[model samples]
Target: MPNSTKRGRRILAAGARTIGRGIVRTVTRSDAGAHWARVGGDWYETLGELKGAAMKLGQLASQYHDVLPPELSKQLARLQADAAPLPWERIREVLDGQWSAHQWQLIAEIEHAPLASASIGQVHVATLRDGRKVAVKVRYPGVAAAMDADINNLGRMLRMAGILPFDGDSLKAVLEEVRERMAEEMDYQREREHL
Candidate 1:
């Protein structure tokens, strides 16, 4: 995960380029397809690397092809729920922190590779010393801080760029919902209960 400042710049820079391109495209009356594709690529690269609220928003937005440009939606769809998994070293750090020494010792074997990867966490299959297999979901490091910065920055960036279709009230409502969902997703206990 990037430090907050670097992440902020990455997202803001993408939004700035998108705004600049939109302006030029509007004035030139050029084909929108390729222009939109480049815009989508910028967003995809930025959000995929960040892997937080904005990326989640992009993934959901990808489904609404009628509302979003097809090219943009296409790129967003690439940031699927099963995003690129983090390496074992990163996952091990979380496990080391969360599990007691006794709990850690119970694992006879654990796969470094994840069965699934999401914005918040990933599931790895582990075998207990007693020979029972279980799936463990480990939260990514720095996700809470990343989500916090992302939520704070994304709306302002979009509004400043004049990119969102909604007005202030509507945008506020949308952002509130994003916040709520982010909260829900981050709560591991709640997720387990719901499941």
Candidate 2:
């Protein structure tokens, strides 16, 4: 019923489809690894598209190169790359909530498309009234609130796949650290002070 649940279900369905397709394909002796690679690739692609905690989990999984096979780590590492961007209309709503009419007047132009997208946010190019260009990072709506659920869903999915390299305690610790970092990243004032 929750948004994260919906996303998790969608990811599971996609995985099921990938496995089904792979099973239907004639498996040669040497193609077994290729089959797993395709499935892993699909899993990482879904995680990348989901972003949020899902992408974070992929990033963490990628770090277990010492424990996992090199090929698996290499495939999962791709999840660390940029994710798909949010639409301009959604970004506009976020800006509307953050800025009043008087504050908005200070920005002369904001590009509809984002310059880059990360797990939790995206950056856009904006021109100030005085013609100074700046990068504005916008957080995805409700991502902070949904962080825990996303992590839980991703962990469950990975465990179910029998591909989790870390033990439960280690996974918990890593996820806690990630949550803290995500919170810090969302704090624009903190970042400004640091800068």
Q: What's the true lDDT of residue 85 in model 2?
A: 81
- Candidate 2 C-alpha lDDT tens digits along 19-121: 4745565553446566657766876777777777677777877888788656667888887785778899988998899889998999999999999988788
Q: Which consecutive 10 residues in model 2 have the weakest lDDT in total?
A: 21-30
Q: After superposition, how far is residue 145 of candidate 1 from its true place, in Å?
A: 1.9
Q: Kindly list the per-residue Cα lDDT of model 1 for residues 1-195, writing each as its tens digit.
A: 787788788888888898899999999998898888888888887887788787787776677677777888787788885387789999998889889999988999999989999876789999999999999988778787888688768888878876556788887787788888988888888988998
Best by lDDT: 1
RMSD, model 1, all Cα superposed?
1.7
Off by over 4 Å in 2: 11-30
